[model samples]
Target: MARLTVPLVLFGALIALLLVGRVTSVQAQDIEPRAFSNAPIGVNFLIAGYGYTRGGLAFDSSVPVTDPQLETSSAVLGYARVIDLWGQSGKVDVMVPYSWLSGTAESAGQPIERIVDGFADPRFRLSVNLLGAPALTLEEFRDYKQDLIVGASLQVSAPWGQYDNSRVVNLGTNRWWFKPEIGVSKAVGPWTFELAGAVTLYTENQDFLNGGTRAQEPLYSLQGHVIRGFRSGVWASLDVTHFTGGRTTINDTLNNDLQRNWRLGGTLALPVDAHNSIKLYASSGVAARTGNNFDLIGIAWQYRWGGGL
Candidate 1:
């Protein structure tokens, strides 16, 4: 009986590993912006006009169910600066978002009020460049024109906004989150592509909604951009971004993972002056399961107002 039980346990463990890989496949591939090389003691601002919608969610062994559709709009002003510590190449990023919303919905058959307000959340990041621009050779020719940056970043969230334990659209989380990230980017021809990923760790949330306790879940995203420079210092690109992730645990127990979220969008670069440009984009939430899904649109403006050192 003991020998039979040992084999069965090993089989079960193998199955669990396969399921875990399937669920985290997309989460490990998402891409995000690399703040290490973008800012070095300069101030850049990001203005976001975004929305979200959630209708039905499909969880483990469960059918799809209708959920509320909520939407919101907001503007985020963020700053990224390079911090030189220990004589290494590192940087930090900070963002404060002021949001507004207008929508009404019913959750569990109870009506909920719409909201419209402004709030702030701070993000901190640190990175170091490793092997800046590794050499590549092809057909007896070598190319080493640009720098390739690979670094790690850590971000934290602060609870300083209006949040009610029963409100789903609150702009804040009462718990702290830590995310470590890595990325690589380099310019080739007229296009520049960037790859980045981050995994988040959730601290204890005594005030989590639904009286739920959750575990650390890693979110994955990936993006690619093909830019072509036109006359007059203007450039445009077709940017494709893919994101996928779900919750890992709830109430200190592994619950059905949250529904995965997917986004599709495009960006157009508009040059304002010799050292300034603005980006406009719009994205749609393709499918959602655990909550309402909404569309998102936003604009970002960046300008270089100082030295090129």
Candidate 2:
């Protein structure tokens, strides 16, 4: 009937845009998994990754600490493109990261250590889909299918990376930041569900460290995902995130570091053919009050190509 209801509504909108292309996050109370996705119109993708983290940071007894530790490792690269817009369906992505960090802190008790590497803040994103999706190709997106869809995105963070005014712990955070998001997805039978919300905005860092001046406020997030699909292409996911406020200030004083966090993660994707794929992930910090109490692991490799262009 109607060609089997348009391939079951384009296969439930392609499994809700493959669970919103697996949302991604970095720092500032991060947690991500499929932010809302659906693809077709041109297509292209590439990704590479490695990550490791272990942390503990709680500093706010006015200004001075007693015990803190952090360890980090990273390497990441990404690219994506899919477009149409006007008729809807759009995408764009970029990410670049490189880091290595080591830390230990204590003030009056004495014991300070620091090690650093380079590159960190670099990200860019833009997404659109605004309801049920459209703009197809790749042979009309192989027939199309959907149940619900909605999307919006904007992400940016670029301070170039590797900054030092004399270090306090630097990888980068010299300034600039952005985030604005909204997402929704749904499917059934083979499962898919998602939700998203975000707010992160900051800019101000006038040297800070020896020169001093920094500021922050605004960071609020919420995320969720549940995905499942199998047979050949494979998929799996279960994730959660929550975040609240960001408080900081330097020369003007005030460094409450306010943040209420919660996170939990999981992901698995495997294909290795028809354009290749492989992904695995992990996340932790079930709850935290200040910030940074981490555990993470990652792996990634993905490739795909322009469909018709």
Give the alpha carbon lDDT tens digit for every residue of 1-309 in model 1: 987755444432221111110001001122232233323332223322332222321111011122444455556555444344444345455556665555566644666665657573445555555545222211111123335656566766666655667554455555666767677766666555666666666566566566665454555555555545443434555545554554556466764546465655555556554344555555555554445444545565553332221
In candidate 2 the C-alpha lDDT for residue 195 amounts to 84
Q: What is the lDDT of residue 163 in candidate 2?
A: 85
Alpha-carbon RMSD, candidate 2: 15.8
What TM-score does prediction 1 earn? 0.68
Per-model CA lDDT versus the true structure: 0.45, 0.70
Residue by residue across 1-309, what tens digits does model 2's lDDT show? Answer: 987765544443343335333333345555566665666777777777777777753111112344567777788777777788889888888878787878886644678787888777788888898888887877786667667888898888888888887666677777888888888888787787888889988887888777888788887888888988764456788988888777777788877667788888888876654555667777787886754567777777766677663
Task: Compare the candidates by lDDT and give the number of the best one.
Answer: 2
List the lowest-lDDT window of 10 residues for candidate 2. 57-66
